[model samples]
Structure formats: C-alpha cells, structure tokens
Target: MSPIEALDFVGVALFAATGALAASRKQLDVIGFLFLAAVTGIGGGTARDLMLGVPVFWVERPAHVLACAATAVLVYFTAHLLESRYRLLLWLDAMALAAYGVFGAYKGLAVTGSATVAVVMGVLTGTLGGIIRDVVAREPSVLLRQEIYVAAAALGAATFLLLDRAGLPLWVTAGGGFAAALILRGGTIRYG
Candidate 1:
C-alpha cells in the first residue's frame, strides 16, 4: 500500500482499539463496540472535512470504516484476554493520538496549502475523535483533563507547520510531529 494509505490504516486501528477498550470498560456489546470504534476513528476526520468544505474521507473511502470495524472486532474479543485494561487503553490512546496528529497535519497542509490552516486542522483532527468517544461513552472528555492532551496535539501541529515552513520535507515534518506527540502523550500518561 502507499505510505499515506498505510498511515491511515495504522491510525484507524489504534483509534479503534482505544474505542473498543472504552466500550469494553462500559460492558458494551459487540454492536456498541463497533459503533464506538467507528465514531472514534472517523470523528476527527469527519469534523475536519466538514469545516474545510471537503467530502469526508471515510465517506469517499470506505476502507477507513472497514479498517476500524475490523479493529473493533479484534479488540472486542482480545480485550478479555488482556489484563490491566487501563494501561492498554492509555497506550493505545497515545498511539492513536500521535498517528492522527501526523496524518491530520499532512491532510490539512495538502488541503489548504497554508501553514496556519494546517495547524488548526491538525489539532481538530487529532482531538475530535477522543471528544466523540468520551461523549458517546458518557465519560468526561480527555480534552478537559488538566493533563497535556490538547496541548500535545497543539504542539505537534505547530511543529509540523513550523517544519514545513522551514522547508523540511513532508516525511520529516510528519514523522517529527508524530514522534513529538507520542512522547508528550506518553509522558503525560506515565507521570501526569
């Protein structure tokens, strides 16, 4: 698969895993798991697309939904076999947050060709999914946490925009943004 496609798939799987974990924590059934996964995986992209007046990525490419559904199924069954669901959930969330931040920034840059717009879109894309997940689960959203959740996304987005402005290659900017977000979020999960 193309690199972009591969990134999207990974992001979808990670987001779906987090969603499934949330559903499982709530004792939700298979359908609920799938629903949560789908929402969490696509919520950010959908919001970004709507704001940009572009067609939603998942609507145009059904593979995104399929990938999330598959992840939901896998996570639903496998979650019972794993202990420390909380730790699993936090790590999966960090992965998804980083992946989405990178991909979203890339998409935003590609769409608007403006560094400012890209940064805003990146933040929107990274955080909206978790917001939707928390709302659906009727839990306090992570965005509201005193921990550095939104701050991490914002930092990653700004890093991507600045790197692009500095004439860095797309891959470099994307990878750096992803790494920054991952490190920051992981730190928060570990010590926050």
Candidate 2:
C-alpha cells in the first residue's frame, strides 16, 4: 500500500483500539467493544468519502473493517495489562489523529484538489471518530477539553498541503504532517 493508504489503515486500527479501551473501562461486553471499534474506526472516513462522492472506504475495502475488529478484540483481551488504560488511550488517539489527519488531507487533495477543503477534511477525519467514541463512552469530548487536539489536526493538514505545494516528496510531506500533529498533541498530554 502507499504511505497514505498505510496511514489510513493504521489510523483505523489505533482508533479502534481506543474505542475498545473505552469499552473495557466501562466494563462493557465484547460486543460493545466491537460496536465502538467499528464506528470509531470508520465513522470519519465514511463521512469524508461520502462528502467527496467517493465509495465509502470500508465498504469498498472490507479489510479496513477487519482491522477494526481485530484491534477491538486485541484490546479487549490486553487492555488490563496496561498500567493506565486512560493514558494509553490518549497516546493511541494522538498517534491515530496524526495518521488520520495526514491521510485525510491527502485524500481530500487527491479527490478535490482544494487545499482549503483538504484541511477541513483532515480535521474531520481525525476528530470525528474520537468524538463519537467519547460520546458513546460518556467521556468528556476532546473539543470540550482544554487540549490541543483539533488545532493539531489542522496544523498537520496545513503542513501537508504546504509541503506538497513546495514540491516536497510524499514521504517528507506525510512525515512532516504526522510529526507536527503528534508533537502538538503529545505536548498537551505531557504538559496538561
């Protein structure tokens, strides 16, 4: 798979893990884990694809759904081994946000060729899944938290666009965007 596609799959898996972690915290059953994981993995991308008039990604590629289901099962069995499931969830989310932000922006740019829409798509792709997860888990939404979540996603998308416009290689552009997002989100988790 291309780097962008790899990032998209990775984002799905990580976000699904976060959903499963939330389910574990709530003492939900395995089915609950699967439900949250599936939604958290694909919700944002599904919306993005629909808005772009593209085939919904998971619908087109069942592997994405498999990734979510596998991640949910893994986390369901393994979450208790972590010292702080909450902290791990935050970190996984940060990583997934970075991946999704970059990947989403790339998709938007590929489909629409509009940098403005690309950034918005990136933000939606990164944040929407987590928002759904939080709401279903009865956790405080990241938007309500005084953290650097959405801004990180925007910055990542913008960074990718800027680097792409500069004619940088795809690796550099994707890396820059992912790093920019992870650093900002990690800073918030570390400092606040």
Candidate 3:
C-alpha cells in the first residue's frame, strides 16, 4: 500500500482501539464495543468526506470497517489484560489523535490545496471521534479540556504543510507531522 494509505490504516486501528477501550471501561457488550470502534475509526473521515463532498473512504473500501471490527473484537476479549496497564489506553488514544491529525490534514490539503482549511480538517479528524465516543460513553469529551490537544493537532498540520512546501516527500512530511503531534501530546500528558 502507499505510505498515506498505510498511515490511514494505522490511524484507524489506533482510534478503534481507543474506542474499544472506552467501551470496555463502560462495560459494553461485544456489539456495543464494535459499534463504538467503527464509529471512532471512521467518524472523522466520514465527516470530512461529507464536508469536502467526497465519497467516504470507508464506504468506498469495506476493509476499513473490517479492520475496526477486528480491533474491537481483539480488545473485547483482551480487556482485562489491557486494563491491567493503567496508561496503555491513554497512550494509544494520544497516538490515534496524532496519526489521524496528520492524515486528515494531508487529505484536506490534497482535496482543497489550502493549508488553513487543511488544518481545520486535521483538528476535526483528530478530535471528532473522541467527541463522538465521549458523548456516547457519557464521559466529558477531551476537546472540552484545557489541555493542548487542539494546539498539537494545529502544530502538526502546520508542520506538515511547511514540509510539503519545502519539497519534502509526502511520506517524510506525514511521519514528521505525526511525530510532532505525538511529542506535543506526550508532553501534555506528562506535564498536565
């Protein structure tokens, strides 16, 4: 697969895992976990597609849905194992945010050829899943927090745009964007 496609897959899996973990915390059944995972994995992309007037990626490719379902099943059976590690879920969620932010921004830029709109799309893609998950799970959404989550997404998108303008390869820009967001998010988790 292409680098961008691979990154998208990874981001989907990460988000699926976060959703599964959240469902586990809420004592959801397998079906509920799968539902949440699917929503979390594709909700942002679906929203972006709708806004951009493009076909939703997951709808075009059923593999994305399959992958999310697989992740939810895996998490459902291994919930106890995962729960034993207190911070595992949190870190995974952060990774999902970073990866999705990068991929979403890249997709937006690809579609609109505008850095500002791409950044907005990036933030939406990174945080919207969590917003949906929290609303469904009855928890306070992360976006409502004072933490630097949205700032990190914006920074990642801006970095990606700068690298793309500097003639860097797309893969390099994507990796750098994901890493920048990850570091910023990690710092936030550490300090805040």
Candidate 4:
C-alpha cells in the first residue's frame, strides 16, 4: 500500500480500538463493541467522501470494515487487561487524529485542489469519529471538553497544507502534521 493508504488504515484501526475501549467502559457486549468500532472507524471518512461527492471508502473497500471488526474483537478480549483503557484510548486517539488529519488534507487537496476544503476535511476526519464515539457511549464529548483537541487537528491539517504548498516532500508534510497534532494533544493529556 502507498504511505497515505497505510496511514489511513492505521487511523481506522486506532479509532476502532478507541471505540471498543469506550464500549468496554460501558460493559457492552461483543456486538456493541463491534457496532462502536465500525462507526468510529469509518464515520469520519464516510462523511468526508460524501461531502466530496466521492464513493464512500469502506463501501468500496470492505477491508476497512473488516479491519474495524477485527480490532473490536481483539479489544473485546484484551480490554480488561488494561488497567487504564481510557488512557490508552486517548493516546490511540491522538495518533489517529494525527494520521487522519494529514490523510484527509491530502485527499481533499488532491480531489479539489482547494486548501480551504483540505483543512476542513482534515478537521472533520480527525474529530468526527471521536465525537460520534463519545455521543454513542454517552461519555463527555472530547470536542466539547475544554481541551486542545480540535485545535490540534486544525493545526495538523493546516500544517500539512502549508508544508505541502512550500514544496516539501510527502514525508515531511505528513510527519510534520502528525508530530504537530501529537505534541498538542499529548500536552493536553499530560497536563489535564
């Protein structure tokens, strides 16, 4: 797979894991885990594709759904072992936010050649899944929390666009976005 596709896969898997962790907190059954996993994994990308008038990603590639299901099952059996699933979820979410932010921006720029669309898409792709997960789990939404969550996403997305526009290589742009997001989100997790 190309680097972008691989990062997208990683983002999906990480989000799915976070969804399953949320389910575990609620003492949900395997089916519930699967449900949350699928939604959290694909929701953002699905929204992005719809808004972009492109084919829904998981619908076109069933493997994305399968990856989510597999993550759900794995987390179902293993979530109990984690002493702090919420902490793990936060870290995984940070990673996912970063990956999805860059991937979404790249996709938007590629499709529409519009930096505005790219940044917006990146924010949506990074934040929508966790928002949906929190809403479904009846947990306090991360976006609603007084943390730097959405700002981190916007920073990463805009960073990717700016660096790419500066004629940086893909590695630099993607890595810069990812690092920018993780640093901001990580500070939130550490300080709050």
Better of 1 and 4 by TM-score: 4
Q: What TM-score would each prediction reach against the true structure?
A: 0.93, 0.98, 0.95, 0.97
Instruction: Give candidate 2's whole-model lDDT.
Output: 0.92
Taking the tens digit of each residue's C-alpha lDDT, what string does model 4 give over 144-189? 7845888888899999998999998888888898899889988889
Q: How many Å off is the CA of 86 in candidate 2?
A: 0.1
Clashes of 3: 0
Cα RMSD (Å) per model?
Answer: 1.5, 0.8, 1.3, 0.9
lDDT of 3 by residue, 87-138 (tens): 6666887888888888889999999998889999999988888888889888
Give candidate 3 misplaced runs (Cα > 4 Å): 83-86
Taking the tens digit of each residue's C-alpha lDDT, what string does model 2 give over 25-100? Answer: 9999999999999999998899899999999988888989998999999998898898999999999999999999
Question: Which residue pairs in model 2 clash with each other?
Answer: none
Tens digit of lDDT per residue, candidate 1, span 58-115?
Answer: 8999989998999889988898998888789888888777777777777888888887
User: Runs in model 2 with CA error above 4 Å?
Assistant: none
* Clash pairs for candidate 1: none
lDDT value, residue 160 of candidate 2: 97
lDDT to native, each model:
0.83, 0.92, 0.86, 0.93
